[model samples]
Target: MKTILKNHRRKVTVYLGRRDFVDNSSTTEPIDGVVSITYRFGREEDEVMGINFSKEMQLVCREIPLKRDVKVTEMQERLLTKLGASAYPFSIDIPDNAPCSVQLFSDHSVKQ
Candidate 1:
């Protein structure tokens, strides 16, 4: 499924679903699904005059639905049923002053 965020400073709902996976192991486990929003500034591997600058930031990171069970809405239920899968619904709210998506390149010599 595809989800588009029209407003960068608004809350967005997300749905995560998974089908069972079979492995040739005696142990069986169900993996928990999670969603995360992270921001990285500067280059961690790049250095200028032996000085490196990098920042690790996280806005939101948590398991889907926050609970251990799946609680879907009516619309979500219909959608999941049509897709032939079970899903967990969750929401992520972006701060009011959150930065909008941007892409920057240090290689000015490269053509766009």
Candidate 2:
């Protein structure tokens, strides 16, 4: 697993392999300019009378601006050329109090 420090900034490069893969004409809003990250936690309970007994919570919702004109690595450049993908670069500043990712198994064990 990789560890990222809190309050530190990390650079990420996003590569879209196909431009025509998404149908933008069907949507009223443009799908560019921002990157959003959301954390969801949910638990399933007994379903009674055809009602869903699942409980869910939105722990985090964050958005950062998608930037461009950044430099790419040599391997990324080669892959971009080979796959004909476009790259978008951005940096994320992890908040100091951001919660770490966690998963709970059916056995009641937790993993981080």
Per-residue accuracy of model 2 over 51-76 as CA lDDT, tens digit each:
32233345435453244455554544
lDDT by residue for model 1 (1-112), tens: 3333212322332333443423334433332232323334656443333432243356456545444256555555555555443334454444444344434343443365
Please give the distance, in angstroms, between residue 38's alpha carbon in candidate 2 and its true position after superposition: 21
Q: Candidate 1 regions off by >4 Å? A: 1-57, 66-75, 84-86, 104-112
Highest-lDDT candidate? 1
Backbone clashes per model, in order?
A: 0, 0
lDDT of each: 0.40, 0.34
Cα lDDT for residue 71, candidate 1: 57
